[model samples]
Target: MNELVLTLGWLGIYAPMALGAASSAIGCAIAGQASIGAMTETEGGYGRFIGVSAFPSTMVIYGIVIMFTLNRDVTPENAGGLFGIGILSGIALMYCGIWQGRACAAAINATKEKPEIFGLSLAPAAIIEGFGVFAFVFALVISAGIS
Candidate 1:
């Protein structure tokens, strides 16, 4: 029993951050591809702008994890803490990007046919961004050592 516990503990101590990072990276990549698909399928020529706009947010997320790792005494047992923080931030950025892309697409369509409906079409996107911001705030709080 003691040996099993020890083995489990050791595994726990070294697995969370690594697994979380890989999983989150995969999710972020998928989200990125989805966003690109949205832009390319809609705007046809705004791929560069969409790519550039999304880059900063993604980099910021990666930087947050790197900085946290560099500055903290992270271990597998506490890897959940880091993973939670990263997840929060990544979700926020991804949500915002997806929402904004949708809004932009809607606006483009509206302008081509009914300009006055632009404001209505934008409401959902803006609301989605708010949810992302809320997630970011909560994640920041947790990552800042509130746990």
Candidate 2:
């Protein structure tokens, strides 16, 4: 019983990180697509600013996750060592959600104006943002020591 508990406990710790990785990867893809779509809709120059604005923060979050994971020995057993994971994860999720919402709105608005380039702006970002939510949940669960 003790061994089983320990194993499950360890899983609870590591699973969040794994989920986070998957989520961020997908989210990035969506953000990338949104950026491209926005640029295309705005005649190239206008949408570039949005991408530029989003890029720095996105990179920072990515850097933090990588730097922390690299510097610290993260494992299922040593789960709670990096206490900042939950906070960072939450921020990342929120950022992605907001970004996706904006991208969706942009796409919808663009579609209304010119219905030809319809699905470009919204779908990718929405899909990727879902992964961000997953990452947030994973981080929350791991931080809380809940499987």
RMSD of each: 6.8, 8.4
What digit string (tens of lDDT, one per residue) describes model 2 on residues 1-147?
A: 545544544443343344444444554455455556555656544444344324323423543453334333344544343334544554565556455545654554565456566646456655755666566555545544422
TM-score of each: 0.48, 0.39
TM-score of decoy 1: 0.48
Q: Which ten-residue region of model 1 has the weakest summed lDDT?
A: 51-60
The TM-score that candidate 2 achieves is: 0.39
The true-structure Cα RMSD of candidate 1 reads 6.8
Stretches off by above 4 angstroms in model 1 are 1-71
* Residue pairs whose backbone atoms clash in candidate 2: none
